[model samples]
Target: MAHETFLKEIGGKSVVEQIVDNITNAIINGELKPGDKIPTENELCASMGVGRNSVREAIKILGAYGVINIKRAEGTFVTQDYDSKMLFPVLYGIILQKDSANQIVELRKIIDVGILQLVIEKLDSESLYKVEQAMKDLETKITTFNVKAKDIFEADIAFHMVLVDITQNALLEGICFYVDQITRTSRMKAIEKFLTEDATEQFLLMHKEMLRVLKEKNKNEINKVVENHYQYWEKVNS
Candidate 1:
């Protein structure tokens, strides 16, 4: 249980998973540098004493996640820019764990509200377009159909992500991505439960108010508006 508290269960206890750990460890230990082509599947199979199928599966998984890149005509290489520093923290939901998901939401409130303050301080016209685009996409997704919960969820994530993006902070983006992944269940619940026709309209109004606040660039009221908008989360679940 203690182990489960920290690590996500990847199912079937696949031995292929170890390949990721081994490769990551290699990267961390400086044995494998970014942009360095890794051994071929046959070579990896021989070296790791694993079957080629497992090696290929592990490589595919890492490739899918951008940890590695498989050049079509060339060989697979460590993703030159893969930051191991952010890997584990992001993988485990910024280290807050599933048990502390409420704290994660609280952290989101703090980060997001802080972002609102920054955005209000520096409301670039270019950034406003991105924010408006995300809002439009979110509204479209939520109102579309029963077939697109994922679309609604993604737009929901993107709308707030634009808030942070406007601040131009890379660390905040990573941290928010972590928080978003961790709090996805609560987000989905809030969207499904409270985003009815009337509620979505109300939601749009709240966002419009936030955009207005950003236009006005008033910092003092940033927290109040952010808190008010986020009450939906508190209304449904932590």
Candidate 2:
């Protein structure tokens, strides 16, 4: 019975899935340097004692998430700058099960409001310039295109990322980085349902206001405005 159970666990798992995990761990641990060429399917299969089909499947899976790249006739190579592709699965599960857009928005707002206080006091000219540039780029995109649901959602993320960056806290910045990635797909879907002409106008106005607050170095006002602005998205979801 124990042997049967062990076989069930192993046989139920895809060889490709196992290979992807191994390679991902190696990358995270710095064993597989960026741009390193992974072994060929046959080589990996021989080395791991896994079948060639399993090795190929693993390579394909990694390629799908931008973890690795395969060149025609060249070779499969570990990505030079791969982020965590595995997190997407967890993100997908969270988004699918939570059914609460407002919960995500609320979490973002809480983080951002804290960041705003720091920015009001510490943001330098260059960081302020970066925020303005991101706003301008978003405005340009909105003006040029019909502003697809995806575009609006990305703009929203970009706008907040600028705020996160201004805080100059590496830990906070890293949190926002992955938070953006995890929420992106769901944000796109939410925007598709809730985004409208009025919503765009409101957000653009809020960006302008935020820029003004930064320029004036108004700490209390900055905190108040950021909290209120983000709360709008929560209201929308509600």
Candidate 3:
């Protein structure tokens, strides 16, 4: 293939954006692969018919998005593994969307339900033990005298994360992790409400029900348990 074909001439109102699109298109089209060295700035500028400044700006954007890495002397290359930074754009988009609370709640419910099914199908003694331990930790945090809302909230996150981790699905894990981040403030508020209302036992019971559902592998009860799990969250967000 001609070197010029790797990044075609730019055509758009935004030179930097066009440059970014060209390079990303090359990647999606398999012209570029993980760890593959990107064309040099001069090469990109010439091929895309853009100025050095445009190429440099586009490269900076890509690097910030975790799509590529720049080594001082070794040159730039596509990232070889997942980077948490990649999720920032997605997190920002969801957060900025208007009337997103209902949508986020729906997304969470679907993900939680599907994840429960996956966990049940893939459950093993070791994973079960880890989940059990996570549950115990949450219980202890909630029952502790004068426990801070942050402590309870962290424990709650840890417990759910263990369940998500058990599936060993990287994509799913990333989605869940960011969704948790997006809802962090609202979740903390809900937790505070629970703590204030002395509803810690009720909150703890909901998790215990989740653990019970996991152990039983009762697909029939998955929906009910998940619905109950989100009631407080939905109420608080509403």
Candidate 4:
């Protein structure tokens, strides 16, 4: 395939950004496959009618975003696998947005509902056992007297992480991981609120309810169960 077909002339401000968009669009459109060597700096400049500096800046940005890799001797290539660096940009974007607290809650609800549905479809004995263990750990943390809110928060995160991981989907896991990071502060605050209100047991019960619902594998109950699980979180976050 001629790689030049992926290149197009730039016609707007921010030449570097337009170049980035062109290359990313090519990747998205399947013109550039994983491990495909992108056009060289000179070629990109010539094809896009941009200067070499703009091409270099666009390449640098793409490399930082983990969209492509630049080797010392080898040419730049599309990443072949999931990269953690890709999450930072998204995480920062959400954090910097106005009313991000509510936005994060909404995002979590959508992701959690989808994750539970996937887990229900793919739940196996081993995965169920792991998830059960996670719930048990959270329960223990909650029941312990004088336990720090941070400890409970860690256990809570672990339970959800297990749910996300059990699906055995790498992309979903990555997205969930970053979402978790984005909500870490709000979730920690929620835990503190629960501890202050002496509502830790209620929180524990919520996790139990989630596990019960998961075992039942009832699609109808997933949304309600997830909504209930986030009640305390939504309260503190809102």
Candidate 5:
């Protein structure tokens, strides 16, 4: 452990952030686990040899990242699950910069593609069944003959959320929360601009293709389907 070297150079929020980085590393490194209570503020202050304010700030920051959760009387504890709330600020910052919005969407597509590919082999019948159910829900919503544009948008969102849950990777699953928020906002705007029954049917068809590829365990085909699916939205939004 590079303990001394890490402690020597402390500046700005760098110091507080470093504390967070170290603690997160510890958790990932298995030095900490879910249900393990973090040290009290006083103990943390003493161990880190930092002021109570700095320790408190570090705790708050980590809390936001879903690394830890605070309980009123029980102190803080490591979370069993990753929370997407931590990524909101990053997403917000990206949104404010118009140039990065498209870039983030591209990044999101890449990550989503990777996650699906990674989990393809591990996908169980139960997970596949869930996907089928979501697909059916989407099909029903689209075939309602007089489906509102919002219904299609919501069905699309539900489909992807199901994909996230199927991944079985906490970190990857967490990204869905923030990415969906951004995607939903943009999709709603686009739908409002150009609402069409054709678009809804097109999306449903693409989802069907995606399900077919997953069932075949064809990674290349899966990627192609997903790429086309996202490209549809990109063309609309662009």
Candidate 6:
């Protein structure tokens, strides 16, 4: 909330970016709580020694991400349900970078292993049925050799998402949502490689075994499936 803090151009970043960073930081640090009205456009421009256009553009960007809500005649307030949606651009950029490709696979491997037990514990018969169907459909799509890679990729995500949804954890769901989203392009490419260079039928069998292990309630089997699946995806990524 210090005007002087905004005045000092400590880096070569754009004025608009700087303002957006400062406001987001303030929200993160609890300096600006949810539902708190932010300073007006005029006040912000004057205090930061920036043009009205800069402030307006920055605010507009924030609004688009659901970080702030602007109500005519009321004012702009920090969103009550604000989460990492505001950081989508930054997160998506990092995830899609060529250098970050392997790291993305590694991240998924970690989350996949971590969620197995939670999913096993909560999965009901209906969910199990749904998962079985999803895997079967994805198996057919991949094995048929006629489906587009993009369609296969989407089906693959949907298949995994059935298990992810079984956990009933909002945070887990949100992370998976964004991960599936920003990597859609690269995942399509990986599926093409998988379809051409990998054994689609064996992959389908492995998926069936995964379902079987879940149905049998076998911890050791689940651990083995997780390890094998991790390796399976690693090859697909290449």
**Any runs in candidate 4 off by more than 4 Å, and if so which?**
9-13
lDDT of 1 by residue, 154-219 (tens): 877778888887887876777777667667888777766654534766766777778778878877
lDDT tens digits by residue: candidate 6, 13-37: 9999988988887787787889988
lDDT of 4 by residue, 124-175 (tens): 9999999999988998988897999889989988999999888888878888
lDDT of each residue in 1-238, candidate 5, tens digit only: 3333223333565668768876777777777778788777776666667788887898988887677999998789988765777676677887788766577668777887886786687788999999999999988987887677788788877888788788777777777766777777677665544354356656677889888888888897766776777765676567
Tens digit of lDDT per residue, candidate 2, span 104-203? 6766777777787788888888888888998897777666556687776677778778888778677677657777776676556555544553466666
Residue-level lDDT tens digits of model 3 in 1-238: 3547767655555988888888888888888899999999988877777799989999999999999999999999999898877777777887788878867888899999999999999999999999999999999999899999999989998998999999888878888888988888888988999988999999999999999999999999999999998888888889
Superior candidate under lDDT, 1 versus 5: 5
Per-model TM-score, in order, reads 0.58, 0.55, 0.87, 0.95, 0.75, 0.75
lDDT of each: 0.72, 0.70, 0.89, 0.88, 0.74, 0.77
Q: With candidate 6 superimposed using the best TM-score fit, by how many Å does residue 233's alpha carbon deviate from the native?
A: 4.3
Clashing pairs in 4: none
Better candidate by TM-score, 2 or 4: 4
Pairs in clash, predicted candidate 1: none
Candidate closer to the true structure by TM-score (higher is better), 2 or 5: 5
RMSD of 6: 3.8
Candidate 2 regions with alpha-carbon error over 4 angstroms: 1-13, 82-94, 110-209, 216-225
Cand. 5 Cα-lDDT = 0.74
Q: What's the residue-level lDDT of 2 in candidate 1?
A: 18
TM value for model 1: 0.58
Cα distance off (Å), candidate 3, residue 189: 1.3
Cα error of candidate 2 at position 90, Å: 6.0
